[model samples]
Target: MVEPRPDQKKGLKERCPELLEIARLVSWCMNRDYLIRSCLDHINRRLGMRARCVLKEKEQLKLHCWLGEYECRMEQMPICKESIVWKVVEEGIPVNLTETHQCEGYSHTLGEKVKIKAIVPLWYADQVTQEEKRVGALIVDSGKMGMPVSDEDFEYLKVVGELIGAAIGKAELTEQFIDSYKRKEIMVRETAHAFRNRIAAIGGFSRRIAELARDKDLANEAKMIYHEVQLLESHLEQFEKYL
Candidate 1:
């Protein structure tokens, strides 16, 4: 792992409190949006810079959450193929760049003068494929000219990216589980309803046949059919209730 710069290491003692808070916040957050928002808020508060979390949505890099003074026109917009964010996503590595103009797409959208300190890619394993994927990037900018990004800040952002990735992966799995459960529930409900309707129809017809039967044997058989239908109806009711 890359180590923090010597000057950044000197201030690590003073950053412990914020680090602890971030740890607590990340651990407690299960929702993707909440986790990203809280993480960005914490980083912005501690660093006094604009922080944004952008997630990949289909082909676009949509802004998931953000904090501070930077205007995010790229929110919900497609990430340009030539942009730095795209580069980080493609490389699956953290990048520190002082000049925004070097990234053509980023400069075109946000402007050439926009000051960006670093962009860190957030990665998570796909639930279905189990393959590692770059889900998004955390972009941090000082919003001022020539502010060098510190190694400690980069290290902290990397940790935040990992936490966000884990949270997003867990949340996606949870959603899939919930959706599967709902589908099963709907199937059960529909099956139960259809079974109940069929049983009710059989019971009704048998009861009517029993009433109209002239022969005692025929009446008794019809009554027995109704009784069996009633039992099946009771079982279906129980099954529906269990579901």
Candidate 2:
């Protein structure tokens, strides 16, 4: 059996410390851009392989972050919105090379030689619903030809994938929570303005009735108007409570 390269041994040594940093960065990243870059950096440094983070955006997954000695082949192509990676992201599963090349769309998008060593899902813990899809995959690549990845490597990738998943999920939830809060604030403001307008109209009517009360001929009419105005004012008070 061929011995693992010296660099590969060093790469294995680096993974533990690098994983700690990856955890910190992923947990804090607020968006696809941050998450992608942070993960790519972690994988490349720790695994000593070309690594990339593909983030799922609307209708497509994009190669947003890459690190390695060679340029990313995936980046060379225009992103296919209809690819399987997008499907996996939509379905919230991590599909490796075994699965990747099996699909026609993915084979065309990610070249054949680029034996995807692993496809690990980055779960976002903040995601309240399982229906909420995965953010992306942490993909590791080895340049060597037909070199089968070891079982241990695949297991390590899975662990890293889970870490990445948690970070992605947290980022997604944080954004969603912020968006929901903003929408509520806007609703409150609109309701307050509507209430204010209603109150102002009632006040105007009350003032008119008061002015009419000064006329001796219209005194009875004005008294009835004043009573109606009070009723409207009371209704406005009730509306305010709801607002």
Candidate 3:
């Protein structure tokens, strides 16, 4: 294999510390919403640029969370496929724009006054198939002056995207597990309730038999059965409370 460039190696080494920090932050987040918000905040603070996480909902891209100077009028809005942000997400590639004025879609989305520099697509790998799936797009803008985004910054954004994707995947799995556990608990509870009803019926019949028995031995056995059933019913009642 061909050796990597010196700058590429340097970039990788430089990202190591930040990646560790990102990993820690990702682990700290327990839910999907928190993970998205935390990732956006981290990216915005680290890069000192305005960042927004836009998720694809239906056919439109909706702003899920953002951090920075730009004030979004509409939280949810339709995005044209021709738009740079949507193009990045749909293509699973990052786009760097040197001149914000040149891109019609960018200007239309943010207006003529605001400046946008770069947009990166956030991808999550499917748990079972390990296929890269587009979750959203991370839009980066520098406002009025139109600051230049370095190549290293693009690399860093990609790393952040991967970290966010992994966290989201983990959160989704946790949700699935919790839901599965609840379903099992409900099944067990229903089964126990059914069993308790059967046992109660049997105990009622046994009590009646004990009352009607002419032989002392038969009456004693019937009474013992009824007593054991009551004990079982008491245990089941306590178990149901836990479920």
Q: Pick the candidate with the highest TM-score.
A: 1
Q: Give, for candidate 3, the lowest lDDT window spanning 10 residues.
A: 1-10
Better of 1 and 2 by TM-score: 1
lDDT of 2 at 59: 53
lDDT of 1 by residue, 1-243 (tens): 122244344245567676677667666766778878888877776666678888888878866776776534445566566666777888898988755565544533354345456888988888789899888898887765456567777777777778778788888888999999999999989888888888899999999999999999999999999999989988887887888
Candidate 2 Cα misplacement greater than 4 A, ranges: 1-17, 71-106, 110-112, 130-132, 144-148, 215-243
Query: Whole-model lDDT for model 1 versus the true structure?
Result: 0.75
Error of 2 at 127 (Å): 3.7
- Cα lDDT of all candidates, in order? 0.75, 0.62, 0.75
Candidate 1 residue-wise lDDT at 230: 86
lDDT of 2 by residue, 1-243 (tens): 123456555343455776677677765667756666666665566556666677666655666666765533546243455555555666666665643356554543554445445656555644355554566666676655334455556666776777766766666677888999989878986876787677567667756766756776576665566677677667767765764
Q: Which of the two, 2 or 3, has more TM-score?
A: 3
TM-score of every prediction relative to native: 0.81, 0.67, 0.79
Query: Cα deviation in Å at residue 96, candidate 2?
Result: 6.3
- Candidate no. 1 TM-score: 0.81
Clash totals for all models, in order?
0, 4, 0
